[model samples]
Target: MSDLVIGLGGLAMMFALMVFRMPVGMAMLAAGYFGTVLISGARSANALLVTETFSAASNYSLTVIPLFILMGNIASVAGFSSRLYEAAFAWVGFLRGGLASASIIGCAAFAAVSGSSVATAVTIGKVALPEMKRFRYSDALATGAIAAGGTLGFLIPPSTGFVLYAILTEESIGQLFMAGILPGLLLTALFMAAVALVTLKDPEAGPRGEWVSISMRMRALMRALPLVTVIIVSIGGIYLGVFTPVEAAGIGAGLVILMAIGMRKLDWRMLQQAVSDTVGTTAMLYLIVIGASVLNPFLALTHVPAMLGEAMTSAGLGPYGVLLLIIIAYLVLGMFMDGLAMLVVTIPIFFPIITGLGFDPIWFGVVAVIVIEMGMITPPVGLNVFVVKSVAQDVPMATIFRGVIPFWVAMAVCLLAVIVFPQIALTIPSAMFR
Candidate 1:
């Protein structure tokens, strides 16, 4: 059989494993390992597996993942997430659908530290949902806001998505981080606009919250200062070229730990949990990276990416047409695949097509991350939707899905905006990196 046919069979088998509930990392590893044995020998395949696993695990840059995750975990354990939510609520809670809007803002803020959609949703949802419930906000609106907002965790700086994308594509981590900022903020605004439109249509769906006095608002902001300061210093340090991404992560994690301890919010137990959770998350991410590393070489041997690119180019679609087709494919895949899994599996195939089309890699990274995030809320396998359901058990899953529909539309709009105005994703990175 042709190597391409073998490659296709391997991919099919990989999906079959995933369908049978195998872990994504394991499925990729198995397919890549076995596929290699079929083409080369067991000897080469074994070497590939060992070298990739060790390389992925031992790579110094991977340290950023654990450190950033630790910072977020410690922040959550220390009640910093709640304080950030309270500050957001104090400032925006008085408007129509304001509480939901506050939840979005809270998610964006927490995402800066967390770099995880699930963590951002859980951290903000726990704090915001109960309060939104107390104010009698619609369950759909409340849950939807948090679910959609959580996706910012993947798009904002310190993002695991960008880190992985950089490693896969050999782009600058700082450039990708910078590329994400404007688009992330744009999505935040569009999400808030979605909340406004929802409440406008059905005013009772999201009622106005009681206004807080300026003094109280400032107090809440003060309470959130520690996290805010850490975000600024760490993320800002990257922008100013004062710290590498790994250094920023280390500083951010250390600063959060110090603040948490100083506030007496993290005791022995909480500290242990934070470290434990970070290790678990980091391990999972490392496995995915390793799996992708193994799979990429197998795919290269089959020339699948080159074949796919030739076919795409032969389709007579111009650059924009090809781009549109890829976006649609992502939306479809987002329905079934986990966002990170989709990224690791597909970037190798698509990055070459995109760059060959003369698009900016950094800009496409932002676009690609945003699209994958939409999948986190898409039905059937919406990871963020499930996370929200766990937090709001009384709310029907269908309702949460319905609630995110508007925000999903907003995301589509945001995607189109960035595509049409590539500068939205490129300007900050260009200015800073230049």
Candidate 2:
């Protein structure tokens, strides 16, 4: 078969492997290995594999991945997530769907400090799910809120996915990080709006809890100051060019350790767990990076992405048409593949097309981050939902899925807004650079 045909064939076989329940990283490796061999035979494939494995595993640019992840894990161990929830809940819990809203806010705060959707979902689920349930929130609303809220991890400043994308595309990490800020806030607001609307309509969906006095709110806020400081320093330091992204991760991680020690949250075991968890997650990401390096050069040999770019450019599809096509494809794929796997696989091919279409690389990065965020809450492969389900075993999976429906709808609107208003994605980065 020709290279194009072989590449297409590999994609088909990848879908087949996924449908058969193979793990994602293994599936990608198997398909990538076989695909390269099919296109250029075993001798070439072997050479390609050895080179990619070394380049991927040994990459200095990639070191930032593990450090950022380590920073996030250390922050989690320090127990800032619960503190965020408590503060947000105290201020908002009296409103209808307040706890659910707090769950969204809490998750957003966690996203600021952590990079993993699963961690955000699991952490917030443990803290807020029961309170939402005790207040007689419907299982759908409660579980769905937490599940959908967790997607913020992908678009927020500290996001692992964003950092990975920045590395892959050779964009300025600080610019991309700043670019995401506005869209992230907009998406978070939309989620809160969704929860409030649901509560307002049913009133029964979210019971109004006792209102906190100003003193109580002040106490709650004080508890969250350290978390606020961490976020401000880490993100602000990078965006303002005071430090590199890697340096910011180091500073944040060290400060988190200090704070955790002061808060009495970290001990020997917790610290060990943080390091171990960071290592494991980092290893998994590098493995995918390895697979991508192997797979991408082989894909590059195929010229399919370039060919598609030529066709689209020649056909006069314009930017809007291409944008629509990308979004539609992501929505469809989210139902079948893990969001990160989908991102890693498709982005290599699509990034070129997107950049060639006259969009700013930083702007496109923000847009892709939003799409990936939606994918995190999307089903079958909705990793966040699975995380919440694992934590709230008593809540039926179906209920969690059902509750996320409106939030998903809200996300759709938010996506449309970003697509229509490029400024929403570009403004922060531009302002920062200016």
Candidate 3:
């Protein structure tokens, strides 16, 4: 059989394995190894596996993953996320739908430290949900805001999505990190606007929260100053060329650790738990990276990306047309697959097509992450929706889905804006790094 046929069969088998509840990394590894052995000899496949494993294990650039994960875990244990939520509430909680907006803002702030969407959702949801409930906020609006806001974790600087995308496409992680900043803030604004629109339609859904005095707001801000300082230092340091991405990660983690200790928040037990959590998350990420490394070579052998590129070019769909199709495909995949799994499964195939059409890889990385974020709230397997649901148990799954609808539309708008004016994603990176 032809290599293309073999490749297609391998993908089908991998999907079937995933359907049967197999881990995505293992399924990809199984398919990749089998396909490679079929196309090349078993000896070559064995050699590739050994080399890839070593490469993934020892890749210095990957240190950013663990350091950033450690920073987030420590911040969580230190109660920094709650401080962030309180600061946001002090500023915005008085307005109509302000509590929900505070949740979004708090999520964005926490996301600057923690790159995981579920972490952002769970952390902020825990702090903000009860307050919104006390204010008699509608379940849909309150839950939707948290679920949608959680997605900011994927697009903001220090994002694992961007880091993984950079590794896969061989783009500069710094540039991708820079590229995400403006777009991330833009999405945050759009999400807040969506909340406003929802509340405007039904003011009773989100009654106005109690306004705090200026002194209270100042105190809240001061309490959150450490977290804000860490974000500016780490992410801002990267843009200023003061530190590389890995260096920034190390500094960020160190700063958070110091802050936690100074606040008496870090005990031996808490420190141990944070380290353990970091190791587990890091291991899972490395496994996916290794699986992708194996699968990429197997796909290259099949020439599937080349074939698909040729087919798309021949089909007379211009660059944007082809991009639209790919975006739609991601949206569909997001409904069923985990976001990281979608990235691992699709990037090997789609990255080539994207770059082949002369699109900017960095900009495409931002776009891909936004689409993945959309999937995080998409129905069926919208991971963030389930995450928020877990925290807000009284709110039905259906209500959370309904709540995210407007925010999802807001994401669509942001996507269109970035596509039309690529500068939204590229301008900062260019000005800063060029």
For candidate 3, write residues 167-256 as lDDT tens digits.
888899999999999999999999999999999999998999998999999999999999999999999999999999999999999999
Local accuracy of candidate 1 as per-residue lDDT tens digits, 89-142: 999999999999999999999999999999999999999999999989999999
lDDT per residue for candidate 2 within 169-277, as digits (tens), equals 7777788778778888998999999988898788898888779999999999999999889889999998788988778888888888888898798999989999999
Top candidate on lDDT is: 1
Task: Write down the TM-score of every candidate.
Answer: 0.99, 0.95, 0.99
Rank by lDDT (best first): 1, 3, 2
How large is the C-alpha RMSD of every model relative to the true structure? Answer: 0.7, 1.7, 0.9
Which is superior by lDDT, 1 or 3? 1
Per-residue error for 194 in candidate 2, Å, reads: 0.6
Question: What are the clashing pairs of model 1?
Answer: none
- Candidate 1 regions with alpha-carbon error over 4 angstroms: none
Error of 3 at 8 (Å): 0.3
